[model samples]
Target: MREPVTELAGAGATTAEPLWRAATSARVRDLAWCTLAPPLLSAIPREFAALAEPGGAALASWPPGALAAWQRWLASADPDLLPPTIEELSALPGAVQALAPAARSLRLGRHAERLLHFALEHGEGIELVASNLPVRRHGPHGVQTLGELDFVWRDVARGGTGGAPQGQLVHWEMATKFYLLVEPEANVEAMAPDPCTRLQAFVGPNLVDRLGDKLSHILRRQLPLSRTTEAEALLGARVDRSEIYLLGWLFYRDGVMPAGLDALGLNPAHLRGWWSTLAQWAQRVEARSPGSPGSLDSPGSPGSLDSSGTSGTSGTSGTSGTSASASSVRWHRLPRARWLSPALVPEHETEPFETLHDALAARFAEPHRELAWRREAPVMVCEMEPAGASAPGWWRERSRGFVVPPGWEERARQRAVQPPRC
Candidate 1:
């Protein structure tokens, strides 16, 4: 407790591995193997309780208001809980505002606006919805044709929509661009239901949360959005803490976070591995409609697969009790596949694809070599004879696909036969 230990070494003084380590070193520096400097592990959720000292406030050397905000957040478990309307929150005593710098959401909202602008300018017809974005925020309102753009804008956020907006946006196209939007902590029905549907319910009396500002910024931006509203609507429903962590980590690790990720928090475990994060975004990209890949788009009216998703999950549900009763969870295991930027697939990541080669590999190689799992879907290559016999049964005969024609190869060679410009 002497000199307010800023790190583990100063706090522990005597280096020894923790036996049943739970309590932290007055400063919450984690006890690692052999007293190594922190490995940049993530902060546990809302455990800022670790920051308090009995009667004193958080950040003992800093502002008391921050501790107050942190404590209030801790009590709610949902940082955005009892969200004082934009009016109420903005008008808080300067003491509270001084404590929680995150409450200054002007920058956060502005960033969102920038995102919408960036997305709308991506290609053609993409729309960046303002907090007051139109249900039909596209085409004639500003569009001309395929691959051609229409419009975009930015403004302060307002009720549900209003806050000090970092910015605002609207677009006409469905392809080419995306918005990384943020949401409040408590709303559930408005957000997309996730893979672990049962675990994320923000209601009932017991739930935990994350660093709100950081979570909202990362998830809304890094994860990609079919449309700004997809996320906007979902935010009104539930909070996806893991997605927030993963997205925040992605931007932070890449140095895109406004002040850098370490400036706030770091948690690789909650965010999952880089491989998985890449996989998640890659899957989202692949899931977009088959409209052109380089522009803001109007995909024959969104939801043509191209309309895309703002939240990570689809909006509808299988509510029939009969269907639910008949449903059985069938789990299947497959090899993990490397994530591909779905938009950049085929041309960007070439593979020697042919049921012939893959089937051959699967029959003789291990499961991973033959079968690949992209997202939750399985893709196994296989070759089968006309006689209804498959060399590698695990490799589905359906995968036996066409090979690149020699004519295309010759054309490629001809195209490569260019005169050097000196």
Candidate 2:
């Protein structure tokens, strides 16, 4: 039985202040990862962690901003069971068909990003992040916390629309992966560890990369422990680990993420930047922490067997032509948010939508409606050429744009191919 803390007559001890304890804990944790910008990142306040876990949502579809708002609300709620009263928390699963808009996830419009270096440097595997994930990285004779890691795959970059009304990382997507977000970690792209210290760690013996005459260049530049990301694109300058693992896998293969992401209800913008962010973090964290020998005991490989269920074409596979060419990819289902009328004349208040964008709007415009809501699935397809690819080089750089595919034409003519829920 535990005894209540009755003060001993001779003892002069007192309970430590949470603020003081947190500060010291943060300082030590900071020193564990970086020395240059030792104070930039702040500890994820435990208070934020206190948000209520609204059980799982039994949603057929989610409204646009609903998921992000819920996640943010959860992240801000009590970490304990108690919530901010029902008025402040509603756990009802929203209907997938119609979701209302909500605030975008932002640390002042900033979002979590992957440490590309850590991911790119680490060997390969899909990073599986469990919310309130318990990442135990063994450090010098002890262990350290992989702070407040969100559920984006360790190797893939993930995010939603970021369109005018960007969709949040949907609640359902987590449902598909068992709420597990996976990414790669072996070919670290961020966390710049000391050269001497890295040599000491027992990793990188079975690296698949070939050795080169510029062996030193590859060693310093392309080795498994190297960290990398493009600094130009990181908006809001905040570090996020959402896609760290995804970047790792992408470095190995891009198909790993795109084909399967929509099933999780993630928007595309964040997904696009996963790799670049991982690179940035791997370099930065390594420069800071040096991940001393055991600080980074590559979280055991998930082995080939465990990866069986993950079909190569899961996230963005069906959405693009290149992806379509690889395998018969079926997109993780998304609620049908179709264009009822042809993409509205581009408002006609400004310059035309190049000719392709304008023609696409013109050619694809026609009223669409679900047939009695019976099998109301949104029709999607990929178009390889747009007005014959404006200029030749654009196709290679940005090959295809996701517009109404030719397949929709059949549905428009038939009308009943898809029925609306209401």
Candidate 3:
């Protein structure tokens, strides 16, 4: 009999709490998807092996964090959402293989959306109506492209489980945001019209991307697309229904919850990451990886690094697993798109550094790094050494989380908010 697909990568090894199993746990799996689904059409079921050429590397190279992000993205496919029932998720090898190609490019966030599209298309009773449809209006001056409809889909069975109707069309607006919490006091004066819109508390790494501005754009510019003549000409009908599929992760310093987080209306299932300053990161890494200055490496802690195993999944409740003195750990620079998810280190992917200083130096030197980490850094999940029984010294990522710098909240607030340029 053929073996089941156990992880995003191929399955030539034993299935002792594989990455797939870790990501599919009942809690995080469901939580991750709460904010992540969107409706799109269906496609032919191609063999898993067929995707090896165009998208194999993208799928195979998904770090632990990206997979976690993917899981959360899938979790967004809950029944109450606007999509049809994805009955094919349980098909194991076929489902994984079919979805693997959706992540053809290394763009992590885009891949998650592609998988969502694939999942919706793979549903039992769903059909693709349109995607990335352009809406342009011919004004007195000339034809102007108002905006693009992210996706337009129809559920052949109407809706999942509820049996709403048949051929129900939906306009889906899918988005992902990674914002850090800040004090509303900083911009209380600037928020003239509505001083207390929840947007005051959360801001992106760059202050320009405020929650208020996004909501304003969606409600004003995006939602109105249905009424435009351009959309009607393209879709042949007014969009019967519309919904926003907004998915995101919030980051904060370790053990420091923002003052007004509860009021933000953020979904409880929203994923989180911790941050630390470069100095703090150096201290933690050194503390965790015990050894001489030159020979720095921490051995694997006891017990299998499985969520269902004895350790019970670190970084979930804002904690981490124990450090192994002899095992080696690597500090990886997470992709900006994948920061909201876990960063998994496969056995072959563990490139340990000689010191914490070395890791930070290399990461900061990279051009186009997330500028938000100027004073603080985000630490992605790292695996403890002696990977699995099959591959020693090959540290496999076991969890998804980050550690942030101290006093970031204050610094975030001190930065002046930029006025929106019309």
Q: Which candidate ranks first by lDDT, i.e. highest? A: 3
RMSD after CA superposition, every candidate: 25.8, 27.2, 13.0
lDDT of 3 by residue, 1-422 (tens): 11122332232213443322333222222223432221111111132112222321111011244345444444343323322112223334454455445333434455446645654554444566776667898889999998877767775645522455556666776666666656445443344343234454556665556654554455456656855678978887666565556666554443244433333344433444444455654564556435422111111121123333222212223224334343445545454533433433444455554554566555655556567464355445343344444433334444333434455445556542444311
Descending-TM-score candidate ranking: 3, 1, 2
Show where candidate 3 strays beyond 4 Å: 1-109, 159-166, 184-200, 206-208, 284-330, 337-341, 351-354, 361-387, 390-394, 398-411, 414-422
Which candidate do you rate higher for lDDT, 1 or 2?
1
lDDT string, candidate 2, 286-391, tens digits:
4322222210101111101011111122233222222122111111111121110001111121121234333434443434454322222222111121111112
Query: Considering summed lDDT, which 10 consecutive residues are worst modelled in model 1?
Result: 338-347
Per-candidate clashes come to: 53, 102, 27
Which candidate would rank higher by TM-score, 2 or 3? 3
- TM-score leader: 3
By summed lDDT, the worst window of 10 consecutive residues in model 3 runs over 294-303
> Cα lDDT of all candidates, in order?
0.23, 0.20, 0.44
Taking all chains together, each candidate's TM-score versus the true structure is 0.17, 0.16, 0.58
- Displacement of residue 281 (Cα, Å) in model 2 is 18
User: Where does candidate 2 have its weakest 10-residue lDDT segment?
Assistant: 338-347
- Give the lDDT ranking, best first: 3, 1, 2
